[model samples]
Target: MNGPDPSRPCLTPESPPHSRGRSCPPSDQLGNSSSSSATTPATDLDSAVQDNIFAQAPSETSSRPLPIPAANALRHLPSPPLAREACDGGARPSPQRNCCDGRPAACNHRAVSDVCASLPEKSFARHFLTSSGTFPSAAEILKKAAFFNSGNRPHDALLLCNAGLEVYAEDADLWNCKGVTLRALGRLQEALDCCREALRLDPGNTNALNNIGVALKERGELLQAVEHYRASLVANPHQPTCRTNLAVALTDLGTKLKQEKKLQAALVCYTEALTADPTYAPCYYNLGVIHAETDDPHTALQMYREATRLNPSYVEAYNNMGAVCKNLGKLEDAISFYEKALACNANYQMSLSNMAVALTDLGTQQKASEGAK
Candidate 1:
């Protein structure tokens, strides 16, 4: 399943989680196999529709992730603990890996030294991918969970994430990953809880902002969703995914306003959508529709062109463009645009009907010319 396409809206179901606890593809394997763990490329899945179908792919993970595997795999740490430590003093049980250096030998370095000297080995190694280590590292577990989340197995992903959170409760990325998995599972409230926890740990996390926004949008909380999306953009103005999401949300809001006859407010939303993401195709389409309704054929045609430029397969945009051209007395151009619409989506009835009309008009004009000659 591909990640969210910035060109579309949020939480669009990418791949159906028809099953859970499924094994991930070997391609998603993380960490090197030998002495050190290898890197597993994270898949940033879209919670919405499938990628190839081209509707709204999913909400953005990172502004960088336009779709699948959008941003750098959620904050990966080196597995197998980078360093081995033998605590001389501090606490009885060392929190560093498997080092069980009892409390700082009576609170003195000498006591700690005495204990280390008495140990059979000066250092210990915990292998992440091997049975030699009693347990997997938090990073490794999270990485595995990411793969599961990407592969349409939210159930397996949730299990791994919940397990990791228990051990690494303060990990922000871990919380973010868990949030994504929960969102994918349709556990909206639980997913929001995870994202809120992630935000508490890192208020500046754009990923969390986007994730929470997706959850909110899915729950019909448009204003809150807009708030999260707007916050994310403020945090990282350079993020394209966030910008795309904002545009999507605005477009939705605008559509609703248009239905309410709030034309001015709808215009503002459509315009703001473009401000958020200039290349957002739907925004252009909306603008075109508005301009056309206002009897501004030329401006409407321009907007439709912009939409088609951004999304070549935009059949509706093409159909609208034909209508605008026809209104402007460009019968040939109208026919061409209608044909383009049909080419993109052969079964589009609107384009087919428009094309027929355009052809009829062209035939009538030709007959008139012959009669005049």
Candidate 2:
């Protein structure tokens, strides 16, 4: 009872310790708190356990960088935030919705999967185009395709692009639009080819370049993705989304570098990412991780705080703050940060484990104090 109530209803591995139990003890109790009922004795072994829990940063698997999808230049939507990375030990949910379908939304809507279910793919474009003898202009067709693609009708969009291409073979926009639809449908190679064709027609096509970057990134070609993203930015520096995409690619590459223990090189990548998109929250979180790795807890805390400020629902950042605080011997602050993380995600196991460990340590320290008295 002096530490955590193991019998608490929601104290399972799947739930945070603070999800359903007594809140963390008051910070003022750090100097003196009742520990007579402490279950774990104060020993070097307890210290070792605490060290093991807080000293080692979470594994890369627990906090790998999330992939940022390339901006859909054809869709013409608002710039989306960079993808959120898992800072500590939880899977970050993707920020996409299944367009009224039951599949994972990351598939860019359920329609992308079943778009051809109702119609025959081979004749769909022919019927759609030939049926209207006086076909719309290439611009009109591209507009309609974009509308359909944005409306989650990627199959219809693809057909429109195909029919339009038959008439307007040299239209770069049509090819780019088709590439977007194909990518949405999981046809990465075809999508890449289409985007390449668009680029061939218009050598400076920003949309096609960005889409190609996306396809390449998906294909695990990070360096190529970065190159294309940079080219997209060079074509039109005003594109905020492209800037974000560049930052994301850099962060991803930096994460790989960090995993490889190339700390200085990784730092350069992260710094460049910040330069690319100053407001990107995940970049800040990644910076915090790097600073923490370099034994700079204060800087790490600031970076984590900035990340949480920019994105309040960042459970991983909060969990990491708690871990850093615990390592710095700020047990009260660590518990508070863990509580904040649990507030964001009640089922965050890392924060739960960390909170329990911090509470146990606090209890042991109090017991030691009383015995000394």
Candidate 3:
């Protein structure tokens, strides 16, 4: 697949740690500050202000693009695995040989004597020539199709896939690829059909299973999506994308349940996701949010801290950590967390707005306490 377009910059890059006026020691070069003693409110507030001015932006993954492959190369691939087997089953001789009239035989000479049998019989080579016109190989077609799909030309990809199927109709990988392209095109029903066909040909095809799961999820069939995701994981447990997708589906289900006040069930889903991938920062962040919403600020802060520790560049975790600190009346801690988030991502508007609010609160509390003196 082609990389992202060069002209379209999707993500913003983060700033260097030293840019925000914080001297992160060489030991903390990776920004793995999981724990630190709370600083004074004034010091934290000052750092937060500096962070707001110098924070970096989030970077996009796809920045450079590549050219698409040619369609001519795709029409010459080998026949489908099933078609090869059929040819090997003594169904017919090679297509390169001429028959009685110097034309390719539709059926072998042996079958011609039995008119009844011959009427229903067909030669593999004849079928192959009819489908692909004896041209480009299967691998070439798949490559071009993939190139088109990656370049956001799903319709062109689908057309190439269809043309390739004429020669290798029973190729499970081609079917799976077709399904993926169709899914990208938002033709969910067609994508499901393609995936099903692939699965029928190769029951353990993980790509087909994953594509089917995605289609089911898009159609709002959450439970069905779960089944497909589980099957996909069974087929290929090492696929992190599948695990992440399953977690997302579970999280969506949990969200619906939570709206119905099913907090315990939501927690279970979140817990399952964490168990599946402890290093997944989003899961930790979501868990922290849930805990915060449930009025357990201490648990929320701990989760947020864990998330930030795992991924020091997680701006959301830092922002949430600051919010929790503010709620707990730990104004200084909140300011420090907010400043760190701003340092990580300058365009983090929420951190900037909240930092301002926290400063105002700290100032008001300070003046009130001074007045009492």
Candidate 4:
């Protein structure tokens, strides 16, 4: 019998887009022998690669604007670049790219899934795929889904996450991502189901718990949302986002209680929220409203001023400040604040109405002074 012929893997012209800044050398080209002799430990090599990946990661604040009100505030806000690139179809690995020589078969699906499953839980790879040189694997799909979610393409993200779940149904992170996308799409019941499934798999999943809180909050289940937010905070106390969400839920509860003549209880809730996050602007604003409603204009003015100081572009705070000034008979100051509110958001109907009232009051005062003269 003739000896088996030597098999060689055919190299394809196309490869997956590079991840982060890592590039894979072409398989056909063997580099200089001297260059290949540098032996780095596997641990060091992995650390170096990760460091380079981190270096290539974009800064989050670089793309975020001041969140000003404008004709196209939402449109002008830069989408997360990582998320945008994931769904762009530019990062996909070529199907014909062989992983090993002499075997024409591409990388197995299980191998791809395993690589994704091994990623660090809180790493950027959990939400974004680096563009250096890594090929599209199952992890890349999950990252892409996350990118879609952050980029406000929740429907697309949901589809990609669902596809990933088909291959790795037991992935708690994937279920969490699916839940987030579902919630963003307003499919609250489905989102709840997905989040519950994620929590069932990983009882300590803070992300799932936080998302469940958001879904419940949106559904007007304020108490339930508060419970979930508290649970999430218990799991990860350092999550400021969850703290903020909890504060909002508490504020909502306080508002309802206040309307029901539970002023003391409402004050307690607002005080708790402020204790949780002293610098939270909305909490201060809500506190100011509570004080104003309870006939304490001085305290209300103090809270409104603090809110505006923390967030200068907070139009509602400016409007509230104007109301406090008007009550104090500081007509000129009230007008100034109302104008500032309108400057921040030209279409603010409340500011417009208040400005008209202030103008009328000023005119009446001027006319009365003229008659007395």
Tens-digit per-residue lDDT, 1-373, candidate 1: 8753321111101111111112222111111100111222234433211111001122221011123331211110000110000000111111322211221111222332333333334222111222343345555555566556545566666665565555556666567767766655556698789878877766766667766775665555657877987897787676555566666666656656765778899899878877987876656766776677677778878877886786676666676677667767788988888888778779766556667767877898999999999
Clashing pairs in 2: none
RMSD to the native, candidate 1? 15.8
RMSD of each: 15.8, 16.7, 18.8, 24.1
lDDT of each: 0.51, 0.55, 0.49, 0.51
- Give the per-residue Cα lDDT of candidate 3 at 110: 37
User: Each model's number of backbone clashes?
Assistant: 22, 0, 13, 12
Error of 4 at 266 (Å): 1.2
Evaluated at residue 355, the lDDT of candidate 4 is 76
Alpha carbon RMSD to native, model 3: 18.8
TM-score of each: 0.66, 0.68, 0.61, 0.61
Candidate 2 C-alpha lDDT tens digits along 1-373: 3864441212111111012113333221000000010012112321211110000111121122232121123210000132221111111111221111322212213332233344465664444544565445555555556545444466877777776666556666667768777866768799889888878876776767776876676555768978987897787776555566667667666766776778788789878877987866666777777777678889989988997787776666777788778778888998998899889779766568778888998899899999999
lDDT, candidate 2, equals 0.55
Superposed model 2: Cα runs more than 4 Å off: 1-133
Instruction: Find the candidate with the highest TM-score and give its number.
Output: 2
Question: Order the candidates by TM-score, highest first — what do you get?
Answer: 2, 1, 3, 4
- lDDT (C-alpha) at residue 47 in model 1: 24
